[model samples]
Target: MKSSGKRGTRSFGAVELLPTWHWSQFTFFTMVDHNGNESSAPYFILIGLPGLERAQFWLAFPLCSLYLIAVLGNLTIIYIVRTEHSLHEPMYIFLCMLSGLDVLISTSSMPKMMAIFWFNSTTIQFDACLLQMFAIHSLSGMESTVLLAMAFDRYVAICHPLRHATVLTLPRVAKIGMAAVVRGAALMAPLPVFIKRLPFCGSNILSHSYCLHQDVMKLACADIHVNIIYGLIVIVSAIGLDSLLISLSYLLILKTVLGLTREAQTKAFGTCVSHVCAVFIFYVPFIGLSMVHRFGTQHDSLLPVIMANIYLLVPPVLNPIVYGVKTKEIRQRILRLFHVTTQTSDP
Candidate 1:
C-alpha cells in the first residue's frame, strides 16, 4: 500500500503532493498581521501644556473662592436694586441687568474649571464641552452689549437730562436689555454650531482647562478655513464693533461732561466711573485673549489662563466693589440693610 502519511512529490503520479509554504513568506505575513493589530487599537495620551500644576492650583483655588463671592455679591446687588424703590431708574435697572449677567458669566466656566483642577480631571463630554463654550462666550457677548447699552443710557441721562425720563423710560430700558440679550445670543450661537459640526477624529484633549473656541477648533480633522473666516468676521463685528461704539459713546459723554462746571463734571464722572472701570476690566483682557489666541504662538498657554481670570473672574468680583464704593446711596443702603453703623455721635 502507498504510504499512509502525507508526502511531497516532484512529478505527477498516483500519489497527491502536499502544499508547500515558504518560511520567509510566513514570517512576513505574521509581521504584517502584528502591525495591523497594533495599529487597530486606539491610544489615549494626555496632550497639553505642562508645568501649570502649581499655577493652576494657585489660580483655581482663589478663583473658586472669588466665584462664590461674585455670585453672592451680584445677587445681593440685584436684590437691593429690585427691592429698593428709590433705586428704580434706568441706570440702576441696567446695573441690575449687569449684575445678573455677572452671575451667569462667572457661573459658566469658573466652577467647572475649579473642579478640573482640584480633582485632576480634565476630560469633558463633547456636549458638555460645547455647552460650556456657548455659555461663556454668549454671556461675554451679552456683557459687552449690555455695557454699550449702559453707556448709551448714561449718555442720554447726562447729556440730555431734560429728556432722560422719556428717552430712558422703564419700557425703553427693558427693550434695550432685551435687544442686548437677543443680539448676544444671535452672535454667539453660530460659533458652537460651527464647532460642533467639525470632524474631530484625532486628538480629543483640549489645551485649556475650559472649552474655548480656538482651542477646540484646533483638534478638528476637517478643514476649518471657512470656520476661521466666519469666526473672524463675527468677532470683529460683535466685539470690535461694540467696543468702537462704546468708546465713541464715552468720548461724546466726556465732551459733554467737560463742558459742564468743575463740580458738575466731577459728579457726572463719578456716576460713570464705576461702569467705565468695570467695562475696561471686562473688555481689555477679552479683546486681548481673542487676539492672542488667533495670532500668538502655541506655547502661549499662560495667555488663556491669565485672560480667563482677568476677563471672566476679575470683573465679576470687582464690579460690585466698584459700584458699591463709587455710589454712596447704594453703599449706605447696603450698610443700613446689613445693620452696619456709619454715623458717629459726640456727647
Candidate 2:
C-alpha cells in the first residue's frame, strides 16, 4: 500500500483512488482504490452510548450546558488576555493559547456529538471522520504542548525571576506556538493515511460519538501493526514527552524555590497553582481513558467513553475557571468585564 501524499488521497496498489458519496446506510460512502476498484463500508456509524439510547434527551441537557460553558469560558479568557496589556506576559499568552485551544477542541467534536444525541445523526462520512479524528488529536497534542510551555514559563518565573521577560519574549512565544502546531500535525498526519490505505472489511460502527484513531482502527480487518506502533510513538513523543518535560520543569522550579525567602517562595508558588490544577484536570482523565481502552473488558466498554467525555470536556470547562479564580489579575479582569456588562444591561 502506498502512503498518503495529500489530505484525502489513499493508495491501494498502482492505480488512483478517489472517494464518492452514496445515500445508503451500508454503503454511505464508496472509495475507489488504485485500480479503480470500489469498496463500500466507507462510512462510519457512530454508536453513541447504546446504553443511554432512551435517555439521550436528558443527556443533552448537561452536555449542551457544558459545551456552552466551555465556549463562553474560553472566549472570556481570550478576551481578557487580549484587552489587558498587563496580562500579555508569557504565562498569560500561553494561557490564552490554551483557552483558544479549548474553544477549538470543544467546538470540533461537540456539535457532532450533540447532533448524535439530539437527532440520532450518527452517520459520519469516511472523509469527514478522518478529518474529525485528525482535528481532535492534533488539537489535543497542541494543548499538551501549551501546558508544557506554561510549565516552562512558571519555572522561569520562579527560578529566574529577573530574566523571565527576556527569556520568553513575544516572538519566542509565537515560534513556540507554531512549533506546537507543526509538531502535532506532523505526528498525526500519517494516522488517516495508514487507516485509509488499509481495506476496512469489518463493521464500520464506531464506539463513541466522535472519531478517535484507536476506536476507528479497531474496525479495520487488516493487520494494524503499523497503525498501532505509529499511534504509540505519537502518544509517547507528544503527550508523554510533554508531561515528562513539564514535570521536570516543575521539579527544577521546586528545587530553585527552596533557596528563596519564605515570603518569596509563597509569592512564586502561588502563580503556579492554577497551572497545576489545569494539568491535573487534563492528564487524570486522559490517562484514565487510555487505561480503559487498553485494559478494560467489554463489560466496562462505556468506561472509555465516559472517561473521554471527562478528558476532553472537563479541562476546557475548568481551565478558565481555575485561572479566573486563582490569578488575581485574571479574576479582576473577568469581574470588571462582567460588571461593565451588567451596568450596561440595566433596564
Most lDDT-accurate candidate: 2
Q: How accurate locally is residue 177 in candidate 2, as Cα lDDT from 0 to 100?
A: 95
lDDT of 1 by residue, 1-347 (tens): 44435353222233222233322111111111212221110111121224666566665667778889999889889988998999999889999999999999888777667776676565566777888888888888888888988888888878899998988889989998998898888888888898867765444555566777777777676788877887788789888888899899889999999999999998999889988998898887887777777677764366665665677788889899888888887898888877643344322
Candidate 2 structure quality by residue, lDDT tens digits, 254-320: 9998998999889878989999999998888888878877777783266777887887799999999
Q: List pairs with backbone clashes in candidate 1.
A: none
**Global lDDT of each candidate:** 0.74, 0.84
Find the 10 residues in a row with the least total lDDT in model 2.
21-30
Clashes of 1: 0
Residue 179, model 1: Cα distance from true site in angstroms: 1.1
